[model samples]
Target chain A: MKSFVVARDLLREAASRRWFLALGLGITLMLVVMGLSLRMDVVDGALAATRLFGKSMNTQIRAADVALRPAFVASSYLIFYGGLLFGVVACADFGPSLLAPGRIEHLLSLPVRRFELVVGTFLGVLALALLGALYGAGGLVLIFGVKTGVFSGRLIVSALLASVTFSAIYGAMLTVAIAARSAALSAASGGALVLLGIVAGERERIAEFFDSGISRTIFRGLTLFLPRVSSLARSAGEIAGSEPVDPAALTSMLLGLVVFGLAALSLGIHLFERKDF
Target chain B: MRRVAWLVAFAALLGLSAFLMSRGDKPKKPERVLKAEFPRHPRDWEEERNRKRRTLPPAAPRPGEDEGIQRKRDPLLVALPVEKGKSSVVFEVAALKESPIGQIWLDCMLEEQAENKRRGRGRDDFKERFGIDLLQDVERIAMSSSKVAVLSVAQGAGRFDKSGWPKRTFGEKGAIWEDTEGRSVFATWGDELVLAGVDVKEIEAAIARLESKSPPQAPPIPDWSAYGDIYGVLSPEELADMLPEEQGEIAARIRAAIDRVDLHVDTSEDVAIVADVNGSNMDDVTDLAKSMGAALSLARAGAEDQGDDRLRELLDYATIKPRDGRFTVDVALPLEVLKQMGPCRKRDAAPSSSQ
Candidate 1:
């Protein structure tokens, strides 16, 4: 009950921020453009793959199949719903104000304990993240219905989940912000990590060099803490109505994110509780 | 209107992806259904039908009309003597430059053929060389001097020798290759002897023909007492049926026998048979002695290198070094300098190699 009030306060504070609105609007516009581009590319790929290898493709399944496909999910919501935002300038405001204002102390002065403050802020960020997730997910649902005449709850939810996963990455960044002595450092660290994740995900050639056993072990460990960030998008793809996502990858990533999320949250609470305001 | 256009484009792409995703496996192809617009070309269609019939001796339907891969287990055996023929073992002794053995094989083959003065081999010596082939260096730079690992994916090159061709991952990433037309190329790369290709079919055919095992040709027919000793033994009837050239090689053997390479083989008399793994066909050892008119070391892809124990032994026997965390093997020969002193000089080993 104590946590709920903090959550509500955190949510209200974030909702009142113009920066949050700007972030929300920016993300939606990007999704709108991205969704358009992906729709074309995924279709082009599908046609080419089908045509070249068409003789091998049984056309009989065309009319029978009616769910969101993996290819479409991959194309439409690459980074949108996984709760990850590429434009992170919103958090750029975390330069000095966060620490300079001694907001943690002010919050502690309130009825809230140190842990409550962290929890409340996290909840607030999450609320914002969910809104972002909805924007992205809703777009995907509209696209899927418009494209395939298939209204699927699974795909919309999957897109939502993917958006949420992205949000976790941002959430982790926000935690870094909370710990920083200066908001600039926190924002920088957050932006850099996000950029690193995006770059690492895309860079296959560089990844190939580190594709040794040790690297795989590290990758598995990372997935544990950032389960939502890592597996959310994948789950969205899998759970999208009509087709089931690949169970192995989804399960593994889910396991990874859960372990990591719980650990990071626990660590955050401990740090916030122990820190000097 | 612009919004509608964007929507339509998105919709089109979405529709296309869904359509592509829904295609079931095994869609109909249009090749096998023959619609012959044959107006007065009855003969051609008749010929085509006849050809198809001949190819399908047992009445199997053509591919489009048939389902999935043909699972016919071919019991084709190639473990015996083929037709009687004289195999001129073209010598490509390019031990120096560690010349990629394939290039030396080709060079020696061309040299031997040049001596015979013939042209128009399977690959054109004329129609624009596959230009300063970077791949040519693949053997010398990639395999020579240090122990290098090759990774080729295409491997079905050497003759199947009637039985299916064996697979060797001589570090190449793909299947080994053997160009037909009976020409194996051996070239010099700095000092590494390397091979790029050899007439795998010609040599396999040659080996198959060896089943005629006439009166044993050379005195020291590599001691078959141990591993792979006389795989093909000719009975007395087989001896009598031997080709005349086999008889001559047999006659040459009787006069003076070459000793086992390990058993103090008289280097004074016979061309030294160095089991040098410095040939292009290192990956495809089936074409060993065939490149040289005189069968030197009967080549096989690390044929002698077998089990883990043997591989370990090779690592032991050869000078071991490391490159990119892999062993680079070099089995040096003291007798190699002797190769330079005589008429048996390999082209790459020769003071003046044919450019």
Candidate 2:
């Protein structure tokens, strides 16, 4: 219950700082630009012609969904990676600001436990990420649906997946901030993890580059525990394109990512509990 | 004790994550077994093109020069009269009829023929009128100028009947019949070869050549180039005439630069066409190849800009490669695209009813 209160307070702080307003304004501007510039001539569920900014893009008629598949795929990827980068940059200062010298002493005097504070901050930042993803990805989906009259649910699902993926990233950011008490270090660590996760997704193919030796073995072993973020993004794109995906693999990967996030948060709480402050 | 429990739970979750990560599926290799064989990468396509060019059989040894060389000449090419600059084309009808593409084409043709028969617009049956099954008995067809020669397997089956023809004898064992209007002549040479022409003198001369009553000339198309389902050599003048009238300057340039074009189409799988254009000189060939490559690139870019994927894909596979003082243009159309271009299967029901 105290964690929920702490999370609510963080949301209030975000709202007071105008972070949500900025995100909403940016998304609205994009939606307006798209709505004003794009035109489609549809006949019997086929796109007879399409134009952007008064310039024709396609001449031959094709099934509306088929013609827009590449656009959906590109949007899904942008949401996945762009949302993570936004969360990393926007939510970085929240943790260090919570653990600031004067605020830490004042918060420690409250009814909340040390672990609850860490868990709350993690949940709060994750909520911010979820809201941002929905506004950005959902706005694009709505625009495409209105213009093309082909509503695909996969982009919305991709937005949700991006938030879940960001949870794992934010957990690490919180852990770094708790240890170092520096916002720059937290954001830098998040950026590095995103890069590492991309490498981890392709580690098997990258392994072929190295010769058979201990160095290759160590590289493989070190990356084995990192979340496969790029693979998740690719799966999102594939789903958007209506391609078949293995549900068992997707479920297992999602579970692994969530568990990793919990583990990182637990480590941060452990570090926070022993601090003198 | 509570702090220790936290550490234990963190360790347990991390271990579980590692296990789950390992359980996640590895990327599956693409399944290409049932799909038509198209090169998935440009480099693979380049290698395939190079390999095909490298593996064409060496040119046939000149007669009387390589006495030890034993090569069976294609009788169809041998039957055609050799003219200095005339274009000749030979269709391996039997081989094409056995290929998948040929089967589709034959099915469509037979269906149309059956429809025509039902409408009372043509012969009741091609086999009855010709004394051989038109679809099954024709082995090869060769054409040059106004003359056409057909080779039939029906001779081996003793189905070739000449009983209804006027028996005006040409060369020995050759008979000629004039059409009712006296505008065309049909001649049969031996049991296997039938020749049709607008001129009686040419048909008689061809028959005389077949009988060796005159001196022999080299076959218009060599045996080495006769391997493909459709093979031919086009004269420079014929090539020039094929171009658009608006491109007269280009046509003139092409005629001045090009000597002849050797064309081949392999329809056993996808339609793979190769045309080798011989030039008057190395520099001319190089310039012509550069122009062709530039034209292809411009067309491909236009297709891409217009978002015409079908034309773009076709242009993607079209390439001009220069080697051995000549240039080869290779193009491939996948069977999938061909199936789409063919008659719709929904209309196939009409054919089945006629069948």
Candidate 3:
């Protein structure tokens, strides 16, 4: 209950920021532009023609769902990557602001436990990420659905996956801010983790560069614990395309990301408990 | 003590999550099956030669020719005349004619010919002059370093009228026909084989080789490698020579680093072209493979930027895989892409007889 109060306080703080307003305006402008310029000619569930800004895009007739798959995939990837980048930038200061000297003292004086504060901040950032993803991905899905009459639920799922991915990234950022009390450091660490996660996704292929010896083994060991961020994004795009995906593998990956985020949040709480402000 | 315990528990949880994440295996790289091997001399050369001799009937010796030689029935492979260090390409025309893309190509060719005829450029009508339908008569066409041999169907050879050709010099097994300018030579052996080359002597040598009058040279491409609708081997020099002048630097680099490239094309459904690039040094081959892959990615990006969706779609099927001192580059055009991009689209729109 105390964590919920802290979370509400964080949300209230976020609602007053210019960053939230800017994100909302950006998505609205994009939706308006897309709705005005994109045109499709559908005949009997087949796409006969497509025009963007009055320029012919495709003349070959194909099933509407098949023709629009690339658009969905591109949107899913944009939401996945663009959302993570935006979250990293927007939520970077949240952790440092929460851990500021006066703010930390006031929060500690409340009934909220130190661990509750960390968990609340994490949940607050997660909610913000989910909201951003839904605004971007959902608006695009609605536009495409209204334009082509082919509604897909996969893009919504992709938006949720992007939010979960941001949670994992934000957990690390929170830990960094708790330890260093610097927004720059927090943002830098988050960016670095995102890059490392991408590399880890292609670890097996990159491992081929090293000769079969200690160097290769060390490379593999270092990347073993990193989250597969790019793989998750790719799977999201595949789902958006209605491609076959292994359900068991996707479940394991989702579970891994959640556990990893919790573990990072726990580490942040441990740091917060040890620090004397 | 509590802080230390918390750190330990975090580490344990990190390890557990990592284990769970690793369970979702990465898609394994497709295994490359090297169907073609580097061309080498057959070790059982003498034994195979003797066995071939024992199976053939003896031919009557000409005044200048050696005895105990025989005219063997041509099985298309025996007439290739490919020599050591030379390049060769064989097209299985009959098999290609049955494929969807092949039919489109033939229709396009026939349409062009008909258009040319309508324009009064009436010289290239093989059906009118020789009574041979290119779509149905030719079985396979093999082109080597200096010779081109077309193996006709059983009934195709009888359709040709030698009287219509230019001046000819009659030989014991075949005749070498000379063009009006005397710059080119065409030879016909038995009934089903027709060969063309720059020099009459080279054409005669090929006929002699087919007749077993001369010792057989090593096959430039092994018989087993010739499995697809089109198969060939390009020597390093040949590869360099085939490149355009704009790609001079690339041609030079290929000549220096690459040894040979074996090519095979399957046209059953999707048109797939696989080139096995072999090099002497493993690092050079790996670098070459990486360069090719990078080039493809750049091209794809350029196509996307230019909004050339057809080019982008075609490039999406290209892939390069390097394994053990060699690499394979594969480009496949799916049937749907072919139907969209092929000449058949215009043909389908119009009332056409070939359909």
Candidate 4:
């Protein structure tokens, strides 16, 4: 609807702020480098906690002789950390523009309805995030293919889904920043949401919530309704060989990206339409 | 934007190269290796250096060294590993019924054992009721009676260590302990353990067969006097055969492995070890002994790789057939013989103690 106009404005705003795009891209690049270089094996450090698992009764097994199971198991330990880092940065990058001074007035003056503006901005960021993901992940695949001689379409697809997940959170937070009075508060709010997720991620209660089918469904639904935070890092993990990506989860994430992107776009437009700024 | 895309593609290639290069860490191999290991060496070197290293390690460098240019062969080098009471056993779990593909083997075994029991033909009688062809191998341990006794030892299934640490029990203290099965002893007298389960009727037939076999009558410790030419002898050439370059390589490898250990020296007291198979048949028993040796060798190599020259056991399987599995085909050495090899050597009491 009118949300498409808002999505374009946000993209144009981010494009104009070239440094913001560079910073976000740079941070994600760092995450990719760190993740790609991480050695996942029986070797010591970084992999220590990973090694203390999956018992084999075969005593004759030598550490040097052990084979890694195929899948995203290699980067399992760092997947969450990867998601958390990039999600925070992505959210911060998207939020500032939504709350930038004079932006609401400029958005309102446009001939496009508020809903179309919402849809447009939402689609615009989603497209950009998808493009960024392909760059980051295509590099990962090239290196991983040479090292292991293995290419997994699942990895690329899952990572793409995960990138969208991160974009969802950024989209939602953009809406929040738009609704807020100050850019500083908007960015802080965006950042705080990611931080809170990280801090609360490992709590048993949260773990139980993730473990429960109902909780997963409800939380997933909420993410779709608002904005997502966990998908892109998970997708990155899939590429980095950390977690298996379920088709159902990816579908949910992709669908959530579209839904939340629309919602955030609409919510931002609604807030901007009434604001005098 | 297209340039950005091209740059991203280039970055992808760079990242790919980085990952590929990092995985290529293959260490160089070494040559002419010499690894000496004692059963137990102290981790506390401050205490060991201050105190007398006990057990006069077999390879100790003596103070009053006699480096005679006159070549005399070391008798121990020529001496063959004697049958210090050799024994053997073989345990093969051949599928009685046709095993199905894609099915779990262990589960099939338990199920098969159950089905036979339902038919009142099970291992409850261990031999007769179950016509499973398990065999026995026996040698003349007793001169008077043709009867052969068999023993199998296994670790008791108890929560010994809940931390999931690999706790090895064999050869620890060289003290023989009863398995939870209470069938075999860990180490009865200065050697490894062998286990066998057999049909007694089959064993009787083995005993009759073994009765016709004459026992090799040899001295408890064969006299070394006749072979005195090699006594107390070390040719300079033999000692020099252990070149500095060879030792350096070994030492370097040892040092690399030392990160996993707390050892301070590269001393090992090499001793004669005999490994025997505990089987129902003589061949079975011998094969079991050979396997015991293979398993021990593997363990020794692993411990050596870890840079600890202290957990070697010069053990051989005694050709002593615990039971006659070769006779019955009802049984052989238990398939679980791998468990009997007791993985880690016991702690060292004296650094110089002759192994």
Candidate 5:
């Protein structure tokens, strides 16, 4: 497909610009530091205790991987919030850069449709974000696995879930960039959306603050479109900890997030089609 | 063609998300059960703490309220010295008797009493031998590391005439009575406060503490007495010493990990219990918390395998959450689970038996 080819070309462009390499290097450095700093005093296959940065934080008896749960959960929160922020920084300019005067003129002159150009660029940035999440979250899992000898599939799935969460944020970032043509605006909007999504996660609690009226209705309606990122990410973390999770809630969250992302992408397409550049 | 493919993918995700949402767990409905009823912390205690923390206005009742009223309503007849070395346990005997567990305990005791009576033993045996009939006379029991005291409503305070017992009259008003051996000290204040303890000094201190005009000092468990039916505080060092000789290693570990232990049990419509174990620092407490969580998980698993559904359900609600430099092991028993107790079932069947 032309879109796939264009996506591949964008990936090559990112590589040439040292974006992917810098991300990979930074992730590797963080992972190495994390690997070195993390110390687990394990006795008889059970994580007896954990010491983070020379401070003993947790201890356990003959419990198997019970101590690793906090780390697993904390790592999930990091991946969810960390990946969102990282994507905002890394993919913020991808859309604006694509719409640059000379680049846009050349790309538009080619056989690639404008929608394809938008979709391809979005997919390309998403792929980059996914790779970054895999490296950062996946590397931590591998390192902890080596140290504790408990290779958790839950951690692996959490990394992928985190990547999926970013797609929603990245979609909004793409829309903001395509509209404003400013990376700063794009990044700020994406960050704001993440914050709003967190608030939306507690929509039920917030509704309790207001009376049952139009104002409450308006607040509830405004949150309907926002992804329940915090709850979804918390559930993802729960999965890793072997805590019970409501599959229906998680599935709804995933579906809601993907729908929000696609809606934003559609809006970007509509804006792109009408642009007279 | 590309748009169609994208649409299909989006549709698939939507379907999957819906399916997942459908699989979400429904909220569980909690069952009601009997609860312990007892005197709780006065509003002033928490207000005082909050004021200390935030420098706010005093939350206690205005000081205009007279001393006579406050003294009469005070929950404990003994003022326990909540110091570093001493451990204190106070049972609200009246409240316990009102609770489901206490009712069962009473039933068992009554059954034992019936058996004793069937053997030609009378109420005099319990009264003469034990020097107290807790079922008929006692209102509350207070125990310290050094002494055990009972408050009774019965008459004739000096009825116990054990031979070779030297009686001494002490206290400012000579209201306190004591034995030379300090084995038993008894005192009567007004009509209700019949206090006794092993140590005359402790008994005097408790009497003076109770009789004093100043407001009682804050206890180790500030909120528990106000909220819980049964509550107690334990010096971790003393508790470790009390451990069985065979459990030397576990005792050592407990001593190493804990500095103080606060226990509160609420057996109302639900069984809500908390054992707050404070350690030397956050690190020690956190370690204890992890171990507690693991132990709970193991216990739950064992209970499940043994088909102890009630225990498994109760343990499922048990958790170890870290507090400020301490860890609280919380267990909430559902009413349904509490009903599973043999005594509770027997009590339910009691009316049927009478019919």
Candidate 6:
């Protein structure tokens, strides 16, 4: 209950920021552009054609539901990929601001557990990202649904997956923030982790490029514990693209990513627990 | 309300994933039907079809047509002799002709012919001039480096006239009709088979191998039915020879690491090409795959930097992966890019009875 209160406060604090408002306005502006620009020509309940930005689409032709797949695909990719990128930027300051001299003193004076403060801030940023993904991706689903009368729930699935994926990256960002206490450094670390995680997902394939030697061993060792960002993103994309998902692969990848995120957060909490401030 | 909002948002996300999982297990509905309209302006329709083909997965079948009916289970590939130790290239023509892409190519050809007829430029009857209707008579065709053999239906049999035909006599074998203009010598195997090529001795050797029990050294016909419309096995050297002059060095390096290459091509929906390059050494296969990946990345980056969207799109679909003792390079071709190549139009313009 105390964690929830702290989380609520963190969110309330974030809402008052000018950057948060700008982010909301940016999302609204993009959706408005999409809604205004997208036009489809329906023939006999089938999507015969579409036009984007007054330029007619020449290739795509399919059933109404299937026709809206491109929209979902675009949104899912953005949410999973673009959301992580944006989360790094948007939540970079949340950590440092919480650890600011006055704020840390006040929080430590309270009966709140240090771990609870960490957990609260983590949840708050996660919630913020989830809401942002939903607003951006969900709005796309609704826009296409209203425009074409073909609604897909896959966009929602993508947004959810995006949020789930973000938790892992955000955990690492929080760890970096605790260690460095610099917003720029935290954001850079988060961005680097995202890239490393993506590479780690294809580590086995990448390792094949090196001859069996110390170089190959180093490559394998470096990526052994990293989250499989690309693999998870692929699963989400498949779900959104309406392609069949390999249940075992999807489940295992999701489990691995969640565990990685938890480990990163636990390590951050351990480090924060020993801090002088 | 604030506390409830967070819980509700989390629950909604979990619920959405559940919804996706549930729907995924359900079988998809059959594809929607479409009618085939005979193209009036063949050129324009060809352009339109080519433009639309980039969307992927091959053209959808016409209404009331079962695509499976066209599949041939026991293809004549069993008759192709794969010589060991020597370089060769093989093709599964019948399977290719039955593919969706094959049907589209045939229809385009027929349309082009029909247009020619409207202009009064060619022979009135294909069967009368060529002695066989390509669509109805020919069943399969296979080619090696030196020889070509065709398996045909009975209608195409004995159609080659021997009377007054210029027969070129070789040392021991009797005179065979020499099509000097076509640069081919034609020999019929009873009624349903024909062999033709520049090297008469190689043609005879191919026929001898076919007549004998399947050679112990013969290369296996790759099972590519699940992967693509056309499948083949070729020596690395043969594969390298097919590459453009600019990539000769890469091709040579690739050939050094591999003994045989299995190729599968699907043009039915989207243009996908998969090449499985087998090498004896695992390390060599891994190295080869890396080089190929690097080459492809360089090509993609170059395309992007140069603002060549088509090349970049093509490169974006290329994947190289190494497994066990072999590596595979898969490339997906964009139809719009292929249309720009003018290959189909060039073939349509070739001399034919209709023209």
Distance (Å) between predicted and true CA of B211, model 5? 24
Instruction: State what share of the real interface contacts each candidate retains.
Output: 0.00, 0.40, 0.41, 0.00, 0.10, 0.00
lDDT of 1 at B312: 31
Model number with the top DockQ: 2
Q: TM-score per candidate, in order?
A: 0.35, 0.58, 0.55, 0.40, 0.57, 0.50
**B135-211 per-residue lDDT for model 2 (tens digits):** 56667778885465545445742232443545488767677887667676777776777777788887887776666
> lDDT of all the models against the reference?
0.36, 0.74, 0.76, 0.36, 0.67, 0.65
Error of 3 at B186 (Å): 29
Question: DockQ ranking from best to worst?
Answer: 2, 3, 5, 1, 6, 4
**TM-score of structure candidate 3:** 0.55
lDDT per residue (tens digit) for residues A8-120 in model 4: 66667766766547856775776576455544332210011122124422221111211122334334323334543554554455555544558645756778655455446
- Across B164-246, the per-residue lDDT of candidate 5 in tens digits comes to 35445445433555666656776654445566776677666766665554545554444324335556788877877986786
lDDT of 1 by residue, B1-355 (tens): 5324433443443344223222211111322221111111124543453243222112233546443533221001111122232111111112222332334334555465554434543232221232222322221111211111111111222222332234332221222323343244322111222233354443333222222223223211122211110011122223324435644553343222211111111122221122211212221221211222112111111223444333332222222122221212223222333333333455556556543
Worst 10 residues of 2 chain A by lDDT: A58-67
* i-RMSD values for every candidate model: 23.9, 9.7, 12.3, 18.3, 7.4, 17.4
Candidate 6 chain A, poorest ten consecutive residues by summed lDDT: A58-67
Question: Each candidate's chain A: what TM-score?
Answer: 0.65, 0.95, 0.97, 0.58, 0.91, 0.94
State the DockQ of every prediction: 0.03, 0.18, 0.16, 0.02, 0.09, 0.03
Clash-forming residue pairs, model 2 = none
Error of 3 at B77 (Å): 27
* CA error at residue B339 for candidate 3, angstroms: 19
- lDDT (10s digit) by residue, model 3, range A44-111: 45455678999988744445666688998999999999988888888899999998879889988988
What's the lDDT of the predicted structure labeled candidate 6? Answer: 0.65
What are the TM values for chain B, all candidates?
0.18, 0.73, 0.68, 0.17, 0.60, 0.62
On lDDT, the candidate that comes out on top is 3
Residue B260 local lDDT, model 3 = 81
